[model samples]
Target: MPTKTLRIPTTDGPADAFAAFPDDGKRHPGVLMYSDAFGRRPVLERMATELAGHGYYVLLPNLYHRHGPAPVTELPEYIGEEVRPAVLARLMPVLEAHTADRVLSDADAYLGFLTAQPEVCAGPVAVTGYCIGTLYALNTAAARPDAVAAVAGFHPGFVVTDAPDSPHRLIPGLAAEVHLGIAEGDVTPEIIGELTRALDAVGLGHTCEVYPGTVHGFTMADTDAFSAAGLKIHWDRLLSLLDRALARD
Candidate 1:
């Protein structure tokens, strides 16, 4: 595998990002991976590399580039119990600043750059995210129906928020296949019902399920909530969706 630190040109500014792709001289499907509120870091880089190894050109951009580059805030090497509060404190404002409008604007730029990359296959791409990144991932797929082929999210926050611009509301615009793995206990039955109804209204290919016994942030190995079984479930679902979507293109 090959990795590079790159700058992605966005409407807001030049976003500093990290990318990984197989070293083999062959173009692969592009995957735009959005990081959680924690921003781009080692855990995300490792995840991107793993995805690239599975035959995709993975790009992980700093969603908070409006604030600064990667490491937008000084995060502890690991988000342990003691440092969790401080990490959230620094992350909350950035999360708040990423309004729906901002997310849509950045999504346009991200998909544009991703599809244009020399290493990427010239076709529809996949988008996946964690936590708040999930909101952006869904919105990105909805906003660019022609470019995004699939959208998958894990442990997403604000999917059921009171806000009118919540990701669930935009489900109708999604032209891509959708897969959501909700954290066990994070989403109530009422919220799940609303989400499923929204997806049904769209009449798109989709699957929404709660991973058994997995708490929020289950895919992050550095988090206390990490669940190996749940993470494997996520990988299986996501890769299958990607294969179907990318194969169509």
Candidate 2:
């Protein structure tokens, strides 16, 4: 795999990002990966490289570039239970300030830069995210269905919120196949039904199920809630969705 640091032009400013791709000199399907509220770090970089090894061009960007590059705030190498509260306390204001407008602006810039990469093939791309990035991934897919062929989220957050602009409410605009791997107790049954109904309303092929015996943020290795089994399932679901949607070789 080959990886490179990048600067992506956006409405707010140049976002610091990274790209991971196979070193085969062949253009591959593009995948726009959104990081969780934790943002970019070594864990995410390794994940991107692993995905790129499967024959796709993966672009991971710093969502809070307006404030600064990733680690917009200092972060612990491991976000364990003891330090989780402090991290969230420091990050809450910054996370809240990232409005939907900013999300859309960054999405456009990310997709534009991703599809234009020399290593990326010309076609609708797939978007995948973890935790809060699920919201970003869903928004990007809905806002540009013609350009997003698949959208998958794991241990997702804020997808079934009461807000009018909730991820579920954006289902009508999606033309892509969807898959959401939920964490146990993270989402209630009633909310799951609501999300299912919303996706059903649009006749979209989708899956929204709780991965067994896992807690929120199960897919993130550095978190206290990390579950190796859950992470394996996440990769299975994600790769299947991307392969079916993007037709990568």
Candidate 3:
């Protein structure tokens, strides 16, 4: 596999990004992978490479690009119990700074960069995200339904919120098949039912399920909350979803 450090021109500035593809030298389907609030790091790069090995061009962009390039601030090797609070404190503000308008603008820039790549196969692609990135992935797919064939999120919350612009509100706009790996206890039964009803109401193709025995951020390798079982489930669901949604001509 080959990984390249690149920049994506956004309204705010040039957002740093990375692209991973097979070394076999053939164009493949494109996947825009949104990083969690933790931002980009070596672990994310490895994830991108793994996805590329499955015959797709994967692009990981810095969600906090407006602040600066990835690792906008130096991230620790592991966000252990002692440093976890401090890491959240540093990241929360950056998370709050991203307005809905900014998210929409950035999504356009990311999609533009992915679809335009020479290594990416032409036509509708796929999108996947983690943590709060779930919102970004949903917004991106809803915004360009014809361009995104599948959308997946892992341990993503805030899908069903009191906010008028909640992610579930955008379900009707999405043309892609959607999958969400929910954390245990993240959402109440009523909320899950409500979201499921919403997706069903729109006749959208979607699967939203809670993974048993998984806590929030379970798929993240660098966090103490990481669960090997949950991470494996994510891989199985994501790859299967991608295979079904992005089948070649």
Highest lDDT among the candidates is held by which one?
2
In candidate 1, which residue pairs get closer than 3 Å at backbone N, Cα or C atoms, i.e. clash?
none
Clashing residue pair totals per candidate (backbone < 3 A): 0, 0, 0
Instruction: Kindly report the root-mean-square deviation of model 3 from the true structure over all alpha carbons.
Output: 1.1
Off by over 4 Å in 3: none
Q: Candidate 2: where are CA atoms >4 Å away?
A: none
The count of backbone overlaps in candidate 2 is: 0
lDDT of 3 at 6: 94
Winning candidate number (TM-score):
2
RMSD of each: 1.3, 1.0, 1.1
> What tens digits encode model 3's per-residue C-alpha lDDT throughout 3-74?
999999998899999899988767899999988889888888888999999899999998898888888776
Q: How close is candidate 2 to the true structure, as a TM-score?
A: 0.98
Clash count (model 1, backbone only): 0
Against the hidden true structure, what lDDT does model 3 obtain? Answer: 0.89
| Candidate 1 TM-score, C-alpha based | 0.96
Instruction: State the C-alpha lDDT per candidate.
Output: 0.88, 0.92, 0.89
